[model samples]
Target: MEKIKPRNFFDRMQALDRRYIYLVVALSIILPLIIPFNSKTYVTEPTENVYKKIDSYAGRKDRAILMCFSHDASTMAELFPMEVAILRHCFERKIPVFTICFMPAAKPLMDYAIMTAKEDYNVQSGIDYLSFGYKPYGLFLPILLGMGDDISEAVETDDQGRKIDSLPIMKEIRNYNEMNLVIDFAASAAVYSWIIYARAKFGVNVAAGITAVMAADNYPYLQTGQLTGMLSGLKGAAEYEKLVDIFATHRDENGNIASREFSKEILKETWIKLSDIQDRRYKTARIGMNAQTVAHVMIIVFILLGNVGYFVTRKKDIEPTG
Candidate 1:
């Protein structure tokens, strides 16, 4: 073994200031948001499956999609964009959509998605869309099962206490057969309830829109076809938004666009043209992805630098002294 020798470079590296690393990390998260830029999102298979499922109901009145918001403000950062994108797709494609909230606090988030997406076009509550807001937690399974018998008896009123059967849109959608798809958006394991009650009982197709952290736990369901599709965090939302941008972009007064013909073959070859988009709301997850990319890259770079410093200092310390 060689004698150790003192070296200025290794000494400086060993004494590096932690405050500098902290500053770099803080800047990594903030700078991207302050200076926003366009970023391309590669759509994943799970998210693409969600887009395809929603697209299948285009211009249909008898068949519809059910959205269940199971999250609150705490997880809005990941799940909100997903809600907006799905709503926009329904509006653009003229698909009948009904929103329900098992968690009381998620009602506001549900309202926000409707309010934001509807700003771009004319969407009426009783006619174009409907909401069953703030249903009790324990009653979720009962309400879901009850819908199979009579939707009106299970869900008696609208968010404002108007009769659900009185709504013009409700004339076509009556039971679980009419509402074929149920998508649960959550930050927790609440999706399991939907998978068990709504899907297992009535044979309704199930999907989930969830935060990235909880995504891994649900993959087994996807493989077994228990989940028809899923959206994981901001990245999944971004992918769904991109698909909607390319396909579902027009509708009629009754939410059916009979004349607007769409071809998936053409969309597959073309990149998403962000320049043509006017609504800034559709770009929320994309902008967030930019910030996430920068922060992740910065962390990897810092880790590499720290390791280099460690090895250099170790080599110097082990060298023979003069």
Candidate 2:
């Protein structure tokens, strides 16, 4: 009787149970969320541009950034962080901010973003920032156009039903002239309305915070200079979060603040640990990225191992017997 040979490591791996693979993949994703590690977030040019644009208006009462909540809860995971990071940037720098939504579904999210970011800062509503709240879709065009002439006259009252003209923030921010930048966070091409009417008509700079899948669709506008900047999905959020941590929020040994212009080279040496971030809400995108990165690496490893095992086992099986 011929002696049977024991299977080698490659042979065993080649036939590894699919359930085991799934188990490992799940763990790889879950473990990162439970215990996130320090990771490098390379800032991209588009994200940096958005940061620079907002940073330019830092501490300026006459200029404010408008965040248009054009999306609902469906794409919140990617878009919410972008809102929080931008709001945190604004709060830290004393930049005036305005939020508005044409859809009723976006009203809660607009409030939530403000609530999350203001927790760590001593910012007052209608003074530091304002919310235009939800308007009917039919009124979207009229409101967009009217903001160019007069913000208070457009929406009249804020989400709180207080006359916006009565608010202190409106003293300088009367129209899109003062609110120079409008960032529409959407899952679709909702930004076109802003670009066509708000930017083309009023000359307000337009940027976007959109889901990753829709990013490609908007790049043309960025190239044409119609879109000022964009936060593309979770990656964009992660980049903005890193920028906020570095320039806006960082403090030295003596408790002195550190603020500087962002560059790709500077970001290379910077690594942010999720545990170090005090605000749990601020760490959302980075934590999500950790899980995504680990899962991708795990998948790559499985693919490589499967390929190696298949080739090695095939070669050995076809070898002539000694």
Candidate 3:
């Protein structure tokens, strides 16, 4: 009887069970979410600009930031964290905020953003922040221009059907003059409308929190200074989240608020661990980033192993007969 030969390492690798790879990919995504570790988030200029602009308005009831929810639920994974981070920053520092949307799909998302952020702070609706709610698409341009003059006139009532003029938030915020900044969160280039209309006509500083895929389209506006700043995709969201942790959410040893201005030079010595975050809500972007990072590394590893297996098997096949 002929002797059977044992499979070599290269052959075994070439024929490796695909199920194992699937298992690894699954674990790479799920493990980070289950047991997170410390990671450094390198802040970018665009994200830092948004943070600084919002921070500048802290404790000011006379000026407010407006968040325009332009995308629907499909892009929430990236945009939702941005909304939460901004809201948390505002609530932590007593900054007034206004939320509005023209699309019906975005109305519920606006409410959800507000609801999620409200859970952690003692903020009153229609006082600390107000939602202009949903308006028809046709009326969007008209209202957009109208807000430049009078916000209450543009949005007669809020989501709750109460007259916006009667809301306490409206006392100091009348038009784009008081609503100094407008950050539009979208999966598309919806921010251009604000730039062309609100920023050009009313002189409101426009910014954006857009999906990664749509970021390139808005960079020109950012460079032109038409945009005050932006949060681009998940990376932007993660950066903003980190900023909030370092400046807005931080507490002192005595449990008093210890927020500080952001400085990249000082951040080299500063570090924030995933485990240090008590609220899971605040960890959303960081956890998502960890999973993405691990998954990408695993893909690279698999590719390297495949190339090695290919070369090893090819070398053996081409060897002279013994």
Please give each candidate's TM-score. Answer: 0.86, 0.85, 0.86
Q: Tell me how many residue pairs clash in candidate 1.
A: 7
Clashing pairs in 1: 3-319, 3-320, 3-321, 4-319, 4-320, 4-321, 94-255
Off by over 4 Å in 1: 1-19, 250-265, 273-276, 307-322
By lDDT, who's the top model here?
2
Superposition error at 175 for model 3 (Å)? 0.9
lDDT of 1 by residue, 156-270 (tens): 9989899999888888888889988999999998889878888888888899999999899999999999999999999998888877766676435596543333455645665
Off by over 4 Å in 2: 1-25, 256-258, 261-265, 299-322
Ten-residue segment with the worst summed lDDT in candidate 3?
Answer: 1-10
Write the residue-wise lDDT of candidate 2 on 1-322 in tens digits: 9868679999899778899999998999899888888666778888989999999999899999999999999999999999999999999999999999988899999999999899988999899999888988999998999989998998999988999999998888888888999999999999988999998888999999999999999999999999999899999999899899888887788977776666666677777777877777887898889898999899999999999999998898899869
Better of 1 and 2 by TM-score: 1
What is candidate 3's local distance difference test score? 0.89
Give residue 43's lDDT in candidate 1 (0 to 100).
77
Ranking by lDDT: 2, 3, 1
Q: What is the lDDT, from 0 to 100, of the residue 100 in candidate 2?
A: 92
